[model samples]
Every structure is written in C-alpha cells, then in structure tokens.
Target: MKRPPYLKTSIGIGVLFIILMFLQSWLEKQPEALTASSEPETQTEATAVQPSERLVEDKRVYEGHNGTNLEHVYITIFDQSAVPENDITFYDLNESYKQYSNLDSGPKLDILFQTGTAKGPSDNGFISFGTDKPNATIELRGRSSRLEAQKSYKIRLQDNGGLWYGQSVINLNKHADDRTRVRNMLAFDYFRRIPDLISLRTNFVQLHVKDLTDPSSEGKFKSYGLYTHVEQLNEEALAARGLNPDGHLYKAENFEFYRYPDQLNHQNDPNYDKKKFEQVLKINGNENHDELLQMLDDINDLSKPFDEVFDTYFQEDNYLTWLAVNILFGNYDTMSTNYYLYSPLNSKKWYFIPWDFDKALGRDAERTDGLPQWQQGIQRYWGTVLHRRYLRDPENAAALTAKIEELSAIITEKTTKELIDSYYPVVKQLALQEPDLSYLGIEASEFDPAYRKLEQVTSRYKEQYMKSLEVPMPIFLHYERKNGRDVFTWEASHDLQNDKLSYEFQLSKTPGFESLIMQIKEQPDFTYNMAALPAGRYYWRVLVHDDKGHEQIPFDYYRDNAGIVYWGVQQIVVPGGSSS
Candidate 1:
C-alpha cells in the first residue's frame, strides 16, 4: 500500500541498518576462517610475522577442536601382518632399547596416524578418511619411561607427511611415573602464558592402537589409554615457534655446563668423540657447536668475571624465568638434564627451554619416591656448576628471587587449581579404565588427595625457595679412620647472612634415621670423633644451624638402585679387618 513519503523514507533507513549489522557480525567471526585442508597452509607458509603472532598460531594448533578437559584422540595403526613372530616389533624394540644412549639407533616400526575426538572407550569417533597411508615411523622415546609396559613413543612423519597439529615429530608420553598424568601438560600450559619463555605445544592425547601382528586376534582397536603429546623440539619446531631454524639446539643429557675439552671438541679435532660429546649435550639442531663450547669454556674459567660471562652468553630474562619457574615448581630433576638450550645463529645469547616436566609439581614428594632431602629450593640447583657460580653472586641471587616473585603472581593457587579441576576429571575417568588403570603409579583412591596436594604446592615451594636463600649452602662431608677411631669432618657452612652457625653430627644405622646410634648437638666445629665400628655398614650426616635457627643438611646423599635417595647421609662400610 502506498504511504506518505516521510514514512517510506524512515522504513528504508531502518532496513539498511539491519543489513549492515549482519555484515559486521559475519566479518568479525571470519578474521581467519580455516577449513581442515586450509589449516596446514597457514602453518606451512612462512611469513614476516612477529614472535607473538607465531606463538598464538602455535597455541591454537595444539589446543585442537576442544580446548577444555575433553582432549583429542590420536589413533595409530601398525600393520605387522608380514613380519615373522620372532622379528622385532614395536613392543620388542622398546624393550630391547630402554637406554637413552641406544634409543636413537633403535629400529622404528611403520605406522598409520589419524586424529579423532576423545569421546569414551566405546566411542573414539575416529575419522574414516584419516591419513590414507602409513605416514609415520614410531619408535620408543624417553629414558626411564621406556622401561614401562606402556612406553612413550616418538612418531616421525615420513614421505607421505601429514602434519598432525602442524608437527612432523609427535612425542606421545605415557607419563608412566606421573600418577596425575597431567603435571607435564599443566607446566606447559602455564609456561606458554609467561612472557620471554618459549613453551612447547602440549596436548592430552587419548591413544587407540590396532596391532595386526597377531592374526588370530580381532582387527578392533584397543584402548592404549591416555597420553600427553609433548611437541618434539627440532628444526621444524624452532621454525614453527618463530625461532631461527639454523640456531643451536641441544638436549642436556648429563650436561652440567662444564667444559669437556676432550669430549666436546670440534668435529675435526683428534679427541672429538660424538658419542661422548652427546653424553653431555645431545646436538638437536645445527651440527656446529663452536659457540656452545666457548660458553662452556667461559663458565669453567673461574678467572673470568661470572657476571660478564653470564651476560654475554645468556639472555637474562629467559635464564631467570626458566630458573624461577623450575624453582617454584620444585623440579629438582633439572639440576643437570631435562632441558633444552637454544641460541639464534647470529645472537650469542643462549636461552633455556624447559623439557620433561612430568617430574615437576611436587610429583616426587607426592609419590614419596625418596628424593634427597636437600633437593629443595636453591639447594636443588647446587649440583650444577653454572647455577652454583651464578647464584654465588648476591645480586644475581636477589634477581632470581625477584623473578620468582613476579612469576608467582601469574602462577598462583587460583590458576593452578583451575587447571587441576579441569584436568583431574578427564584423567581420572580414563585412569580408572583398562590400560591406564593397570599402570597407575599411585593408588586409585589417592588421585583426589594427590591433586589436592598439588593445588597449593607452588606457594609452598615459593616459601622454600625464599628460605633456601637465607640458609647456608650444603657442606661437603669427609670421613676417615684415624688411630682406631672414626673421624668425621665437613667443610664449614657459609651463611649468606653471615650469621653464627652451629653443627650437628649424626650417625644412623639406617638412612632414614629411624634410630640414631650417635648424635652431637650445638657443636662449634665441623669435626667429630667416635670409636671405630666393627665390620658393618653405617650412615653418617652433618647438619648446620644458623643464628636465626635455620637448619640446612649437607649435600652428600645415599642413592640406592631402587630409586630411593637419602640426602645429607654418607654410607660408610667398615671392612672385615677394620678396628672396633
């Protein structure tokens, strides 16, 4: 119906406004709409993007379709139909090569990799058109973890390479030792949020395996249980994370940053030994290690100013953050190994990147695995030369404490509890099921309590770190039999606060000190005299107490083959001919 001209004009304006609003909403959602096929293009295409941009992109790739508690499921199939019964299979290879030294040289089995949503054991929802062929090679990964029945695996994409989460090398860890199975993922998630830190992409993976090795068995997929996928640090990883591809990257095996002139030499040097060199720092990226050797040389040279050497070789922010995070988390395993060192091709400054964090978050404490008593706070890092030297300086030590306080604000009880709340349910659900249920490190009932303990562990560790700074450094104990009597002497403890210190000498029949055979309290000297014992084993320890009533144990420890570590105790054996 024809209306007045004024009314018609108002109606037209209203209609146009509605149309524009819809267009704006659609555009906002489509900032970068990625289809399944187009996802790889975004990751593969090299662009002049900032490190922050690359970090966001990498984070998105790892988060997957469901970023919450419900993780993604990765299904791997190994068609061993043609292989003989006695021939080495994936399981056999893992068993045969448990040592880290031989793992790289071990045989890898062919695998078909696929992605799916983690529903339940009944419904994995595996994509029917997942990677068409066997696109990857699977091998055993990890040192001690390889010993478990449910071993960690390293999957390397082959010629028919399809990037699973934009990664060519995917490390699926069983977390056999970690009961929660979420500690490593928890650390990675928090580390990603911290600035100046390069965090690896981590995701919880529910794995299903179909092995055609046994012909009599049904061709149905078996639930291998839950695993955490820690992105392998490699050339591809460095590029994906927006770091220089040609940079130096090494995994610290047994490295303490000491200058191993004989082993860690130039490839052309007469004393150059690849095997021995790798026993320290395993070369992961560029083969050239000239810069690394130089850094090590400077670290070992006491004549060189420590501050200058540290400033020249390390990015202070990265170093502090790395040390601070590890300290706060009580990750004692990182004193020597369980980390990666990286530096750009042009830049002389090296950075520390965290690796293998399953042992973090008071996991050892929770399990009562007999970790050394001294493996707490600043003392945890005392074993390493670099840390001992760097922390010896009051300024550097204070800087570390400041960094710890700054990071503590971000990684608080609230943030940690949130992660635990979300992850515990998911892990517990599967952890009670078949495969994972069998290999539970802790009792099924202990899950709730264990996670509860971790909720406030960071704060507790922070207190310990602060306390460690005030206390004296651990003393080195020496024992000898002099004139039919046992003589115990230790290096004098130097309290940072310059407080008067008193010594306590203890001799125990057992390492745990259930009963003490001899005890001396408030002794001014570090030496103790006692009658020689008959043929037997004994554990002796020394403790220092400062004027402020802060006590610290000696660094000496007694570690048995059963993974029990007792600190501040030295085991002495009196031979059959020893005087009584």
Candidate 2:
C-alpha cells in the first residue's frame, strides 16, 4: 500500500529532519554549563587534553532552589567550521545553516558547573566534559521576548559520569511569554497531579552563550537568561512508564494523522530510503509505527461507528479528562500537534501526553466556535475525527461538561490555586537568577507577572473554581431588525451557586470600541432606535460584574475586580427609518 492516507507529511522533509536530528543528538552529547565566574571556590575546571579538547566538570544541578528540583545548566558553543559567527543567520533555528554542517562532531565544547550550589559560592567538588564536534542550531528570536538576543542550543545532554539526569535529549524552553515563565511548567504540573495522566517533567536553568571561535570575543561569555528544562517524550519516556520501549512515540504536528512509516526518518540514518516507511515520524523512536497507523485507519473510517473505533485505541475517561483540563485551563493550544501518542504492540490501546502548554491558564482566551480553536490552530490537522464525534453528541457533551466541573472542583479545592500561587516565588526566583537580565527590563521588579496572573486566576477562571457554577461563557444568540428598531439578545451568564453577577454591556460603532454609543449594565438584552441614529453596522459584547462591585472567592480569599466573566460578540446593521 502507498502508506496510509491519514498520515500526511511534506513531499520532502528528510533534509530538514536529518538536520534537526543531527542538532538534537549533538546538543545532547555536549557537557552542561558550569558555575558563574563569580563563584571561584565553586569553579568548574577545564583541562585541554588533545586537539583543543578538554574535560569539563558539569555540575549543572541543584537539589532545592526556588522550591523546585531544577538544574542551572550552562552551555557555550564554538563555531570551528572556519565560518565566522557573524556569517550565521537566524534561519539556522529552522533551516540548516550552511555553516552548521548538520554533523555531530567538530565544534569544541566546555561544559562545566559548580557543585552543591544553586546560586551562591560552594566548596564542594566540580565535574566537566567536552566535545570537539557537536550538531548545533541557533535559538531564534521573537518566538518569546523582544529583549532576548539570538542564541544557539541543543537537545542532548552529555553522559557526564552519572552527574546529570538519566534523560538525554531535552528542549530548553526560554520562558518567553515574560508573563509567567512557568505557564508550560504549571500546565505540566497540573497534568502530572491528575490521576493517570502522562506528564513530562520541567525545571529551571541558567544559560551562558559565548564564542570560543570568534577572534573578537573568543573567551568572552554572555548571559542568555533563564530557561525551562523540558523533557522530550521519546522512547526513553516509554521505557520509564513500564510500556514497550521499542514502541512508537509520535509527536503530533498540525494535528495530522501520523501513522505512515514513510513520513519520518531515523536520527542516525542519512539515506532517505522510501521503502523504510516505518521510520517516518520526526520524533520517530524505536522504528515501528504499525500499531499507531492501524488505529488511525479505524478512527478515520466513518463506515464503523465512532464509539467502536474510539474504544479500539483510546480510554474514554482519559480523553474526557484531557478535554476537561484543557477547557478549564483555557489551553486553546491543546491540539494534536501539542500532544504525543504512545502505542504498544497492537494499536488497540494508546496513551496521551500533552505538550507545549505556554498558552495555558494565562488569559481569558476562550473560543466560541471552530476546530483546534482559532487561537491555537496552526494550519494543521485540528484533531482526530473521533474527537468531533465524541463532543458533537449531546450525551457526550453533557458528560464532558460534568467532567470539567469535577476537575474544576479539584482545582478550586485549593489545589490549583495553591499550585499557581506557590509557583510565584519559583518563577520570580528563576527570573531573578541572572543579575544581567534586569538591565533590559526583562525580569525587572516593575515587570512582574504575579498580580496580572492572579487576576486571570480569579476572573477568567472564576466559574471553574466556584462550586456548582454555571453561566456558560456568555454567547451571542440572536440579533434582528424590525419595526425600525434593532434588537440584540444574548445568552445570560450566571452561576447556580450564586446568581449575584450582573450583565454589563457595551455597543460601539467601530470594531474596537474607542468610542461607545450605548453602555448598559445589568442587562442581557438591549434595543436601539434605528430611526434616531445613523444607518450603519455596530458591534456589541457582554461583560459580567459582581453585585458588590467586586467578588471575593473562597480559595485564598482572592477578591476579583470588575472583569468580563464571559465573552460574546456580534455585529448588527441598523436600517434607519423616519420617526415622528
């Protein structure tokens, strides 16, 4: 067969895949960064042995700092390919830089770290290691913060004599949003806390990027700021979970059905063999994806009932729980691409692992319609067809809402609130780790995300944290023009636990209400006299407010400000008419 139709990938992605693999493998093998230069007693010594190579003691680990188990690993890269650092461009972050070579060997490395220290100087021993050749990629810009400078990074950590964690490859997520550096980490935390969910681990780290090859600043190093150490869901992860280590672990992209073996290539293999379809997954681990493909075929085959096929692969509760968590957290980013699917020998059963949750629990970014959500959809496969079948049914919809309510209870039982609050110091501490970060207002005191994050938790997440809460994110129901008047009505947003919220409404002539024609409070419906105004289209939306001007929540006694509890928007054409 010509590889399953469901697993569609680019016509030719092997070159890109090969380059990425080389970069990841080489990055992993390089030694971790050592202590800050200020800490002499905790210094990591580097000894040149042969061919500009040296042993770097990498003590990029810490036991307890910022109330989390994380390591401050430093990395320094040297371009030895005769091509100058200035010659490299930003495209190296994706497209292979002509100078990078996509080879795991060549560049000189110095990975060292101080022992028994999170920040301050220590008297303990140090460890180090080095690599002459490392596959590399540049850390590109605008993906996170404007203050950030271009840097280079790799996923693989070197085997430094049991000093570092067993996991090899990882993507260092530079806490980019600048709002809550821990947005992804917190989502991972919640996922791990939930029963039976497969969640990856993350920690904080400090980075140092410099040029040992550039004649201008060969020995000089610059701070790249703090980064979140995120573990990749690879074959190693499967082994740790007591599952078949040799099974397939597919990292989703564009929500496509990635069951074809032809779409991916193995990390070490350079030759693009069309016959070796089994190795097509980009994160393709252990060489077999047959089980996964079968499930996809079944899931997409409309001939069979959706329940029958869904049962063949996924556990209903897990699916529902994932849905509930995403909805509750407003993780609009929860698409197939941000998830990893694990399959054993036969595709009859699979496990779900959510990934890249930087968009979670940060704002009231909810969607009223569409798949993969407008905010999260990245022009890729939105999700499996089975997902639509489950949520599309009234019965299933009710069950999922109930599940969301149940999870909401657990979150409001002071768990999620505590989790969110306790992490404030950790995030703040991580941001404050490097003294140089503040000069650019990156982690400055005036730029803290604590208060705004609190507002999000209390306002956007208000209904979820409250007991037996209702008011389903107010939506625009109907609008009409009759009898020379414009009438607009919307679904009311109220809580069953306490009907103490009032409807705050605003209507404006423009899309963004720089000026408003009508501002009404405590009303779910409004009417405008068409005969009394100009003929044109107007925009409107509803905002919910508390009866007491502001409301105090149970968990942490968080008093929420006057905010839009629910959201809905619509436009109406006012047909002007003459009136007496």
| Top TM-score hit | 1
210 in model 1: Cα distance from truth in Å?
Answer: 1.1
lDDT of 1 by residue, 1-580 (tens): 1112112247776676566667656855784532212232244424312221212224443444332344554444455544222255555666666444568777777666666555433222223334434656778888878777888888887655557666788898998878778888889888777866777777777787766554544756677888888888888777765456787889999887788776799877888888888888889988887888888889999999887888788767778889999988888789889999987676677888889888888776766656654577887776678988887766677778888989988999999988878787678888888888888866789878876887888998898787787887787899999999999999877666778888988888789999999888877777888888877888999888888988888888888668687878898988974333
> What C-alpha RMSD separates each model from the true structure?
13.9, 17.3
- By summed lDDT, the worst window of 10 consecutive residues in model 1 runs over 48-57
Which pairs clash in model 1? Answer: none
lDDT per prediction? 0.74, 0.48
Off by over 4 Å in 2: 1-70, 79-152, 158-163, 216-221, 256-281, 363-384, 429-446, 449-580
Best by lDDT: 1
Where is model 2 poorest over a 10-residue stretch in terms of lDDT? 48-57
What is the C-alpha lDDT profile of model 2 across 397-516, one tens digit per residue? 556656666676556535655766666665666566554344323436644645345434623443543322232222334567657666665554433234477666677876456798
Candidate 1 C-alpha RMSD relative to the actual structure: 13.9
